[model samples]
Target: MNGWNLAAAVLLGAGGTAALWGVTTGPPARRVIAQNMTTSAVCPALLLLSQGYGRPAYVDLALLLALLGPVGTLVFARLLSDDLSDGPPSARVLTWTAAGAGAAVVLAVCVAVGPGRALVKLLVTGALLIGGNIIASRALADGFQGVRGG
Candidate 1:
């Protein structure tokens, strides 16, 4: 496979492994954090795979994931509000790391695609992914009490 595809594979493998381990073996808070992480990890890999496969459509899927990831996390946060009420779940290092990776992948894909509408879409997706990651992380940190009117 090409460098892009290979990179995607490697990222998916390592991230998927870590996320799986985290989701399966941790407390409810940690598992939720790890589950949130799964999207951050996969979105960029989806972009990379899109670039590698020469499929612009996959970018759309990435965008969808970027949009939905935080919503899903928020739902989880709402459902488990009691479990998380003790304290917010903060994984700052992992959160920023995932955001950085999404940014890097977006940049790489943008470079490969050059200036065009595609670039704009990629930028939006990246923004959504990074923004969503930050928002989800923060919401979890706050235990989403604001969302629940607390």
Candidate 2:
């Protein structure tokens, strides 16, 4: 594969591996964050793959995952609210790091594609990926405290 593909492979390998480990061997709260991370990791890799392979399908997949993955995490967080009542997990560091990586990858891909419908889609995907990620992380940390109080 080319450099893009290789970059994708390395990212998937490193991020996926770490996320997998965290998910499999942690408390429910930690596992939920790890699950969110799965999306952060894979979405960027998918973008890289899409660029490397010159296939729009991979971008579509990345977009779908970027949109859905956080929803899934929020659902899990809501379900596990009891476990998180103590306080929001201290995951800001991890969350921002993952978000940063996603932003970087998206910027790289956007540069490669230049301006077009594809660029628009990439920006949307990146926005959703980073925006959704922060939103989901906040929900996880807040654990519906405001909602429950109201």
Candidate 3:
């Protein structure tokens, strides 16, 4: 098969799985799911597409997208809160801890998928993250509300 065809398949697979995950998991988890799916699919596809086309621009674009990963995260946080806590350091710690934990899970999933199976791994990882995030986000929002007396 041609390289472009392969890349298209990978992107489609990832996007499809992610979309399915988002639909199944509900709103709380959709963003994380989408982010993971896109990154996982895009990264490996870019690598292949770059090689096939004999151009480095695809790689650059992939890297740029990866770096912009925080945008969805920030949006998620904003959705969870309209309040800035002033009461305790503990609450701040919990917030940071939750974010850190979520990131670590994604990184671990990516590594476990490995270089060769990156695309497949990305698709599954995105779906899993979306599922996990849906549950975790709700729990976090609830916990934070308790801590802040909201």
lDDT of each: 0.92, 0.91, 0.45
Q: Total backbone clashes of model 2?
A: 0
Winner on TM-score (2 vs 3)? 2
- Ranked candidates, highest lDDT first: 1, 2, 3
Q: After superposition, how far is residue 104 of candidate 1 from its true place, in Å?
A: 0.6
Can you give the TM-score per candidate against the true fold? 0.95, 0.94, 0.43
Error of 3 at 50 (Å): 1.5
lDDT of 1 at 92: 96
Worst 10 residues of 3 by lDDT: 83-92
Q: Order of candidates by TM-score, top first?
A: 1, 2, 3
Stretches of candidate 2 off by over 4 Å are: 146-150
Cα displacement (Å) at residue 77, model 1: 0.6
- After superposition, which runs of candidate 1 have C-alpha atoms over 4 Å from their true positions? 146-150
lDDT of 3 by residue, 1-150 (tens): 665547546655765576566536645444443443444345445545554575544445545544444345445444544332322112234334434443544454355435654545444434443444444434433434543434
Candidate 3, residue 60: lDDT: 57
